[model samples]
Target chain A: MALAEPPLGRTTAPTRPAPQKVWVERIPPIWWVLGLFLLTLPAYANDFILFQVFGWTFILGMIALSLMFLAGYGGMVSLIQMSVAAMAGYMVAIFGTSGIAAISMDLPWWLYIPIAILIAAIFGTIVGALAVRTEGIYTIMITLAIAAAFFYFTRQNYTIFNGYTGFNLVVPPQLFGIDWRQPVPFYYLTLGWAAISYGVVIYVSRAPFGLALQGIRDNPRRMAALGFNVTAHRVAAYTFASVIAALAGILLVWQNAQIAPGTAGIPAVIDILVIAVIGGIGRPIGPFVGALIYVLLRTFSPDVLLTFGLSGERFKLLIGLGFLALVFFSPDGVLGLWDRWRARQARRGDPLTGEKGE
Target chain B: MKAFVTRHPTWSLIIGFVVAVLLWLIFAPWTEGMEDVLGRKRVFLNAIFGGVTLGALYFLVASGFTLIFGLMRNVNLAHGSLYLLGGYIGFEVSERTGSWLLAFPVVFVVVALLGLVLQNQVFRRMEGEELRQTMVTIGLSVVLADIMLWIWGGQSYTIFAPDWLSGPMTLPIVSGYRSSGEAVMLKYPAVRMAILFAAIVVGVAMWLILNRSRLGMLIRAGVDDREMLAASGVRIQYVFLAVFGFGAGLAGMAGIVGGTFQSLSPGEDTRFLLASLVVVIVGGMGSIPGAAIGALVIGLAEQLGLVYAPTYSVVFTFLIMAAVLAFRPQGLLGRA
Candidate 1:
């Protein structure tokens, strides 16, 4: 990972395209290059490849980003972010149109989006209030319970949730004479939202609230002694994190044009956790990279295995093994490996050049 | 009110239950048809029976959960995997031998050995580091469950009891607890009775083992002060490892037992794991007696809740756990 870093003034020759080291790190040209490459994918890639693989990957990555932000920064591993996202999805279905044979409110896009997000954030805060009291594993148990409870409530309560078959037919609105559900539009929409989400995480990790959360994660009692309202900060972190997840939830519903119990089930919820951890919970970009790997494996593994005379279900086995290996070897994930690799190359290069190391 | 209830929870619970029972008895006669056909009193009795049996099964699972926590403080999320693995293995054995009775011992040994390897390979390395331990176990569980799926073919399977304990045991009861005290004949499954009996035996055996046996003394000493035990030249690490394996073996045995009680499926691992978590919360993390009591409460509440409020049966488990945690963060029998 460290090997990928720009070794600018070293004896090893560097590529001319390296951006000038600035006082404040500018948005690197590489991001724009990558973004442009992705933006142009719809030209070559089919609708199935664009929407299900790349677009869905971006949305899942966004949801995982929320979990990464909390666990990576706040040190609180919560399991209710999926439930919080489900709340938004359900809200969208209730406030807007759905497949359920009922009178839908069919609220406008602008109105329902904010209201759904607002309700989701409020729901997150309420859950966070209950969860923030406990420490470590207990917190995980509580959030899991709450998520399970919500799943049951939604599944059994037919009147509101439309029973086990959750609401479907939640399509993206044609706000500017363009069907957002179309492959190109959807892909760009997902990419744009992902970039925004990524930026938000990066920005928030440097903010006072984010730093305070990390402090609490390190030692809540010490932080409390320093006059920080530990629970409040933790709860607030949950709210912010939930908002991010809710946005992803809404996007997920839009991507599939439906929401069901399976969308927020235990396995699905755990998958988000897996993605975050696999991506390396240490940095903002980890989830997206992990999502890319996950999406590739998820989308193609079945077909790939088929060519090798293996059954389709082996993909789950592969995913589980992949997760286990990643956690066991590099807890910091792909990003950590990259960092280590870069640091290694830099070390080796320094000695070869006889450069005095720090 | 909260403070008073928290301080005097046991007494308050007893009083509340008595009042609720009396109220149910008074109002039961007014309701007729399907809801009251068995007689509300009889339904309550049946629910209690179901709860007791289910709770016994829960006890079997949670005891192992509690023991591991008590000794190593490692929450083996993969414990559930051992359970299903044992059941699946036991099923294969029983299917081959045409005798379900012989599967229990086989399951116990296999699962125990598996646990020993897991402890040595995974838990031993991440000793006392709860987070990584949890991650490793989660990984193990996912891998194991998938492997089971690959082999078991994702089809649900049930383990059957031997012919001796296969049939239901009919009981005749004359009751006066209700307004109109009448004679009632109830048919309860013998398998349930066996489970309850097994739970009692296991409970007593664990108590005796922990109290009377030298190994138990070492375990107790290890729990109380590992530093002291180690300082005194005892290889306490092996004891913990053995205890972990033993707990795992119990899980495997419970899997076979639970399989007979209910069908086994891939996802059943997580369900049992969740049940064990709820049991741990209510029973106090490391207390065997606490596990027993918690299991009964959860089992009864689940059965009764399914009858009374069918939609909320699953919710009751967490609801009870949440209530216990909210009122007593240390749990009912857990020490602060």
Candidate 2:
């Protein structure tokens, strides 16, 4: 059951060339307006909205971006990506100069952050090593088992993870004496990290490893026949994705000023998957778009519904309906539809006029 | 039977059984000088019984999961949601009609019909698109869980059983001797025994249905090769529908049984979903006997770990799963 390749000798330039570059050049006008709006709104928005909702959304978007790299590019769908981040978050809290035992032991941020990322990366490697042998749903289940096991261990092991209450880790020291927790400071910090992560993801997506991974995604057998060590590449992809998630995890702990099992457990893990899918899979900007939608729904839907006398819990129902609708209508996600529309318009244009007009 | 026994050597079987028993003995809490402690031995035995009952419930749900995956090659991630929805439906029906028996079958039928409709409408439309189907099912699961939360509050609810089944039975086993020179006593719950019976019946029925019936033959053929079976003039869609409904109905039945064993909460959907996924992976997807073995391993590991290493019980299962996958990904009794 391999799919047949499209026949060669099809017209390559007539319907495609100009608009492909045009769409690439034409940045959506809405983004500029939206950016300006966001730049101005922080001054007027409440501290809670700016710090908690926006900050957490950015952090979550960062984590979802890591999963997107694997699932969208490598065809490796995993459920334990959140667990890797959670592990990093927990390590930060455990090793940081906070929690119950912190009076006896403390580590500087420089030393602690690297150690946490290393620990999370090693954990991800081990999981990937075990999971790479399976295909499709088996891979998903194995990751889920790993995640569930971690959740249970963290929930019950109080001496180590501080038990169910979790650890109240100290926030990162403000740069140049700026109060990071202040709404504007935190939002900017989150946005800066998000931008860096997004840029790295885009760069990686176009790199040789990304192309090879996409090759494996399209046809693993062919890639293997072409001398690519498929398993090794998969493990490498997972490790890189894990590092990305770990960065987000560190940021998450910093934003919340704490790390709990609940942050990385099944519900939160599944929510990340929801966010990725809602935004669009395999697209560079999907995670950011999805995060915006999710954060807005999570933040405002409760108050919006409460005004109509409905309970806040009904917000989940709305979110659930929205998710279903998105999946039904746009399986490739919003970005996919946008790309398709541009392609359609390019196919409809007069190809000969392009060079003549130029 | 004699020929079969002779051809299949019993050495591996005997060794496996002995090892399992030794592991149980080593991990059993009652052996840790706990007989003298008041109610410690009782609690230990109760936990074992609880574990076994829970294993049966897992088998019930995973049986359906494996069957669906085997027949259609679609991993119904929403199976847990269907189970949760079934529990809520059963809860509502039982509350309205004041009859638990009516609620049981009614919930099963409703969920079965729901599965049929979903298969026809959503899954069928996305046939051959495995990833899309998976995502859509996940979306549906989230929607169902949210809707269920809206209808039934997130607080846990207990399913009431009759007085006869609810009470405990005193089984006078040599539950070990106390340091104070008294015989330890253990009272197992009657509900657990009832669950054991249900497991046995379901297991046997599953065997007979898959091996002895015409419909079972068609299902087996479908799993082996759907296109060939269709080429043979059999309508594969009807078989897929039947298998899908049967699988979902099994999940509903499990919900009814599990609701009595554990508190049914909105969160249990995700917990059970994860558990089902683990079972399928460890047992090898689509194998009934494999599901049974996987459930037993997970259930026993969890129970024993809770007794000896409570802090690491959850991690223990994952470690076992990892080891199993590393060494024997096909799982016990599963085809490679």
Candidate 3:
């Protein structure tokens, strides 16, 4: 836990032996139990606890999960994931009437859903096209710039994006006569989608394409020599990740009934990065866990800080400190810490992270 | 002139001609209020003054950024936070000592020490690991930003220039149909002029150090081939440390220069960082001359853009960057 002492970068890479067995990866029984427990939480918890706390965490987690999918498996960092999400949210608001009549065309809700997701996917692909050619720092800078561009565009373009005020009062449409925004219904809707997306990410990482991506991440030139199309794979990864983020964006709009410029702002984008990173980038579950912690800190930090006679803005200070600590101590993330704890318990002296020791 | 133009038309003449025409096209229309000659002249002069001063400040930040990044291949995203720290410290120091000049060295020394700790602790540990370096530095910046917010409050602050530089001064150059004997000199803020002068000094000093000195050769060599440079027995780590400190020091210097004129806010750190990125992207990273050109272009575009389209001033820089990236990804001066 004393990551400060370890003088990081002691090694070049976090190597672990790839898990070879297939049968061991079956949907674990604990997942079913955890899923069931999560499903039932809405029944016991009140509206605020169910919707605001859990619902917000799950929605934000979905965005972070999309990031994790790219960063963990595809070996790309797309800061535009949140932008894609916000785009979907904005699309829904524009196509359907929620608020900002100046921009809203007031089309049917169903028509906009696919269009939003498709646009986001296309946008993601375009961003990836611009980004994938550059390695490392260039890739990060380009994506960040694109995200910033989107934020500025949305904030300044009044006719379409409604400027900084953005669109408000966006509620989920009724289907089958059940109000989707209702606490239990909303929670179930979010949970069901989150699970499917999580499953997709897990499945893809084990898929041949995902393996190819990982190979490219390790050495794109070698992968290219081996006949893999590195750019295409990277672009495909962005497209897929964007679709996931877009869906979460739709859900995000419904949860807040509002979508604003701040939703796609750099700080918000960076927050998603922090969540994905703090949760653990190595596995699928890390984002949700990270999101849960982030939500708790954000929701409760006001009361927590008030006791210490500190302003709520200082909550950001705590979050920043927590992020720095997490990065230094467990670069792999909270899930990485969990794995290390598990490895310690097993007493096998196994390497705690991805790459197996030589 | 003809021989020079014929010899290097593509590299020198065409680019220069294009830039000149573009500037004329953008600024020519501002003379619409020529009927009020004084007003038109003042506006034109202010735009030029503002653009150059902003560019100079940007150069200070980007020069440091390009140096650290080029030499070590490390991206210290917290460079902006270092700038903010310097400004805030400068703000504090200037307030305490009642002498604004004292803030410069105090900030330089403090930020350099902080940079030393950061390099040894964070950057050193993550050599060659760009992703980890980015994440750690980002995290460090976030922490630093939040801490500053806590100590200085969340609102924006504008540091006043010391009395000498606070007021506007009349320039020798005049505009419109000024009478030969009249004091029709263009009035400009002394602070901005000082900053422009400082930026030029830093720029010239950096050029001399990089192009003329043995250490400059080593640093350039390090940027070109770190392994080869180190294999030749130079302590590359020391070079990285020194450059990192110098870069941080430059950020601090910009913070002081900028804080005195432009407003300093909590969010300024990210804005400055992004501006530097655009600078580096336009100017080839690791090339000092490249950064200067990039900053001037971006700064002028930002000011002109503000005049033409107030809401989209920032977007103009990104457009420039996007255009550059599309045509020349290595940057205008960056070696392919």
Best by DockQ: 2
User: For candidate 3, lDDT tens digit of each residue in B53-125?
Assistant: 8999999999999999888887778988999999999999988898888889999999998998899888888
lDDT of each model, Cα atoms only? 0.84, 0.82, 0.86
Kindly give the stretch of ten consecutive residues in candidate 3 chain A with the minimal lDDT sum.
A349-358
Error of 2 at B263 (Å): 1.3
True-structure RMSD, every candidate: 5.7, 4.8, 7.0
- Candidate 2 stretches greater than 4 Å from native: A1-49, A99-104, A307-309, A343-358, B1-44, B96-98, B170-172, B177-186
For candidate 1, the clash count comes to 10
Number of backbone collisions per candidate: 10, 0, 7
Candidate 2 chain A weakest ten by summed lDDT: A349-358
In order of appearance, the predictions have TM-scores of 0.90, 0.88, 0.90
Model 1, A1-358: lDDT tens digits are 6689776657565656587778445768887789789878988999999899999889989888998888899888888888888889888898888877583588898999999999999999988887876778777767876787787778887778776989889998897899999988999999999989988888888888888888998999899999999989998999999999999989899988988887888777778878888888888888888888888999899998899999977887888899888888887888998998988877766756778444
**Cα error, candidate 3, residue A310 (Å):** 4.7
| lDDT of candidate 3 over A1-358, digit per residue (tens) | 6765765655654587556768747769897789788978877889988888888988999999999988888788778899999999999998887767777877777788888888878888888787776777887777887788888888887878888899998988888999999988998898889989998988888899989988988898999998999889988999989999999999999999999999988789889999999998888899999999999999999899999987776888788889988888888999889888887656644456545333
Candidate 2 per-residue lDDT over residues A150-240, each given as its tens digit = 8887888887787798878557765689988778888888888887888888888899998999999899999999999999999998999
**lDDT (Cα, 0-100) at B241 in candidate 2:** 94
Q: Please identify model 3 stretches exceeding 4 Å from their true place.
A: A1-25, A306-312, A348-358, B1-8, B22-42, B172-174, B178-185
- Give residue A66's lDDT in candidate 2 (0 to 100): 88
Task: Give the C-alpha miss distance for residue A19 in model 1, angstroms.
Answer: 16
Pick by DockQ: 1 or 2, better one? 2
